[model samples]
Target: RDRGGRGDRGDRGGHRGGGHAALLPPGRTPGGTQHAAKEGRASLRVSGVHGPEAGLNGIYLPTDVESHDFSCWHQNDSFYKVWLCRGPRAFWIFQPASQRGTAQGFMISKERHLERPQDATTWRLWRDGGWKVFSTIHVREASPKDVDSDAARGRAPPKKPP
Candidate 1:
């Protein structure tokens, strides 16, 4: 997640203008153009779940975005969902815990705002006996309307027991 601070300045693919770009070694520009990553949005979908958060299996959009760093996603209520980060090996999803309704769901990126996994990958959440586990993750481009719809749904009042 783009923390919006200097925390992600070290390894983020792109370089921010003004002070940071001047520090780079000569003759080597950043991977992409400046502010290029802030163009679009991404969607992350979790499937084949076998844990507490199984019912939360759906498309997640980026909740927080940064101009130079990748976006990050978490549930609106809690923080148990997976975080998308630019790991040594492309994109990786890290699930901190297994608490249900821990947080909201959203998609994020590194280097590129619209970046998605090359293919559906499996990930394991082994914390506390695997409280949140999934077999497949799907990433894709998300439109602004899509995001607004999901946000509306999230804001809708909960229904009472029938």
Candidate 2:
């Protein structure tokens, strides 16, 4: 399931970019243009179940987009779902424990923003089992009118139950 995430990243073959692009080392992600990856991160999802034993795991996008790194999705809430994209960039997904090194301890059900700067965070340490995670959001692209229209037609994004 580990496919095309920006972090804990490994090379894959599918899409092919032009030869010798500067964004990555030679022969990394092929056909993935600088424009695609530069535009933003690709959409991806987590692999396997969540647990302390789980450590960090796979992060990959759909096969259709394995070679690209740009996405457009709608989001209006204070928080939205996201995933780490595939190489030099990633969000660093982890077990979400209360204490950084204690993935074996309590784990948060879901993610909030990173509370500390990248330097201060222990969850990023591979030994702690942290892997990069990311997503490119376009909340700005979803207008209030579009939102109203979707909500009126019942095509809106899902709302959390109050």
List the candidate 2 regions with Cα displacement exceeding 4 Å.
1-139
Q: Per-prediction count of colliding residue pairs?
A: 10, 16
Model 2, 136: alpha-carbon shift in Å? 14
Local distance difference test, per candidate?
0.34, 0.25
Ten contiguous residues with the weakest lDDT in model 1: 99-108
The C-alpha TM-scores of every prediction are 0.38, 0.20
The TM-score of predicted model 2 comes to 0.20
- Per-residue lDDT tens digits for candidate 1, residues 67-139, read 1243443332233344344333233333222211111122212222234442434343333321233335334
Best candidate (score: lDDT): 1
